[model samples]
Target: KQAMDFYDRALKLASTIPELQFPLMTYLGKGNALVRVGRVDEAKRVLDEALAVAEGDSAYGYEAELLLQLGLIADQQKDTARALALLARATNLAQKAGGNRIVAEIALETGRIQRQASRPSEAESTLRAGIDVARHMAERLLLPRLLGDLADLQVSNSRYAEARALLEEASDLLEGLLTNASSPWVRSRIIDSMDGIFLARVRLEGAQGQNASRLFAVLEQARGRAMSELVSARDSSNPAELRAGERKIAALQLKLLRTTDRSARQRLLDEIFRAEEELAPAATESFIRTRASRRKPVTLPELQRQLRADEVFLEFALAEPHSYALIATNHSARIHRLAGRADIRKTITA
Candidate 1:
């Protein structure tokens, strides 16, 4: 999982690359990567930046791809209405741009959202249609996830045999993909990408009273190949500080696209260079050093020693439909479930 900052060059983001080439895909791919790592808001903003670039270039193809990504994000957020609206627009743009591959991608996502909303028949039709298009277009990547999603629908309807066959076919395709992808980084991405297949299989096995641990081992086999490449950054990095710097870089990059004044553009270029130079180490490194950092883990007893008698340490996990907190004092610790995602969002919004 890459960050939004991974794809930026210091200043060479001149004009726009061909929609087929990268710096365009850079923005699009990085946005998708960020979403995979659960950085939802960051993904949205980066995609917005990508859209800005596409609009500047009048590259409607890139716009279609970017809109598809944004729609996927909206789907994750469970804003079905917004997701559908964006998908409809993306489908139109894709057709105009001759982006059949994107249309197939759109169908897969639209189907999943429909499934979530309990429109089973529509979802199945949409997914099956996507699979056909994907096959015709050689979109091997989309086919497995499409299969997995359709399998999920089948499972919901208690069509166990159909679901099992679909999952097995999806798994076989994924295995072939993994076998062909030789690069460690590429293999890691492939493993992450096919998570849906394993998930669907898990559901099928669970529904049929098969051993879930056996399914986990199979899934683990897939993930084990990429374990080294997938190590997360240490907890010491200050996300807020990093986000500020990256946002500045993004703002300057967008400004670089719009400004016609030569010297003003040069100044912006120089600033972006400096900011990128400063941000590079932290952004790329496995561990980043920060001000007054705690680089080493502390045991609970040791952590307790650092607290004042009147004070307690509280760690909260804010999740959808509910939240949780771990409260620890010098003597004791306890976990408490608090609010739903909506309630928490409302409070945060307020």
Candidate 2:
């Protein structure tokens, strides 16, 4: 909100200045700020205006970024087709502009949407391509999430060993992260990776009778605090700290866009990183608190204990080309292999 306020005030002043006309950049900044505050509708309107202004201008990276942001909004609204279209174009633009990070991110989203839409083949190919780009860029931060996402697909396909390998890689990447100055978003992804690792371990053990005791120990170490402590921890930041950090980040980003000097741009980037680092621990704590406030996740033992005398549970794990199910009755459990999703759907229909 403070960041939005700053941009709002700046635009009001900049609008009146004859020598400092930057309507497109200003609108984009404010739109981004609005997005941070969850004012998606308003952001769409402003970003649309920015898009109109960007056309016929040489804003290569900016144009791609705007499309990506708009695509995210569309995704949030569940407009799958529109989001995919926007993201596809954004991916092309980002790739052409050498924005590998953005390209990887866009690809990840594209693959995710494809998977959601039941286009597993396309999702697998897209995810592989994105992982390749991320590797080329050495995009350590996003790579773990990408790997985890792909591992999930692999799990569903019953590629248990492959999925476990990917999960281990992702978990390793996450383990290397410095938690002290990490964003809530990053921490959330880390937690998600941990979940993926656990799931893959279960699937592997079920399928191959491999003891995952070492893996579980490693996971426990990776997840520093106990789950109970994590659940009980309060938000670490006051409103003032959040507001100040957000404002500084926004200010630095806005300055980065306006400045043409290489040294100045570098300085602005550094400042933005610093600001984000300062906000990371607080954001992470808040996210954990909020997540814990919701329903606690069911443990493997808890799930097993929930089965009734007459009931059986079949936990299906699906990947691109194969599927596996862990079938459990009250007394016994076994792993069964099945054909891919299409075959399963056909069988169910029949």
Candidate 3:
């Protein structure tokens, strides 16, 4: 309410002065404030008014900023095509105005659009170009964001090692920046990116089974820290910090579930299922309950079917407890006797 009142006063003052620069800055400030408050539709409306005024006055520079804001708004609305078009126009206008910072920003946004559209090759190229330009111009603040975006593209493309290296560099840059500033936004972004790298590392390590125990331990420690941060964030005065903490908690939980063992996994899933059951009665009355579900029992023939379905699973599933455990647990005595006959047939064929 206070912000809207201030904006109204500033708008009136700008109208009275007519020659002052307050109108453009005031509109941008109010629009940003609206966005921060989750009033994105209102922000877009305010920015549209600002854009009309700037375009009518031939204020090319301010017009570019408004266009960039509009592109971001479209992105948030999931109108990727519109975001790409608006961002491209913003880039062209910024370049024409010799505004390299805005150009870099548009490039970054373009890269993000490409990434979201599953065009990682294009995203990598565009973001790399933007990062190069930002580096050449010594735009210290923009560099880390661009680098992080590029790393995300790498991760999307399954280039885990490369992504890890890129994220590490970004983390170093952000750490340095955070030391001299109190920006919860930047800190949160950095921590989230670092968490991604750690989770990726855990997945790779777990798959290899090399140092798996150590990797799982590290993941647990990270999860604990992330959850603590989330708890602390509830009381935090900074909204950005709270949001960041929540995101971190979600990511950590997903990573933890993906990395935990079968027995531990079943326990976690059971706990979650029970919690939902308890909450369901209080939240809504028509909830139906059933026995806990398990994976479909795999017979020897079913194993062959699964092998055909996923050839990659053959290498891991054919060996050890996974292969023998199911056969031992689920098969009847007749099926166990048939297994010996099948082995003899395979031996004769060999």
Which candidate has the top score in TM-score? 2
The whole-model lDDT of each prediction reads 0.72, 0.71, 0.63
Models ranked on lDDT: 1, 2, 3
For model 3, residues 266-302, the per-residue Cα lDDT tens digits are 7666655655555444322211111111123223343
* lDDT of each residue in 1-350, candidate 2, tens digit only: 78777878887897689697456567777877787788888999988877765655656566788898889889878999999999888887787788999888888888888888888888898889899999898997678778877887786688877877887887677656524324556655666656555555544544553433332333344333345336544544446777677788888888999999999999888888888999987665565445444333444444557888898876665532455665666666666666776887888999
Q: Per-residue alpha-carbon lDDT of model 1 for 1-350, expressed as tens digits?
A: 22444465511453344334436577777777778888889889988887887778777788888898899889889899999888888878887887878888899889978878889998998899888888888787888888888998898899999998998898888778765664446655666657767656655655554443343344345445335233432343456657788899999999999999999999999999999898876564423232122223235566567888899887554443345555667776555666855798888999
Q: How far off is residue 157 in model 3, in Å?
A: 1.6
Stretches of candidate 3 exceeding 4 Å from the true structure:
33-42, 178-350
Per-model TM-score, in order, reads: 0.51, 0.56, 0.53
**Comparing 1 and 2 by TM-score, which wins?**
2
Which model scores highest in lDDT? 1
Specify the poorest-scoring 10-residue window by lDDT in model 1. Answer: 286-295
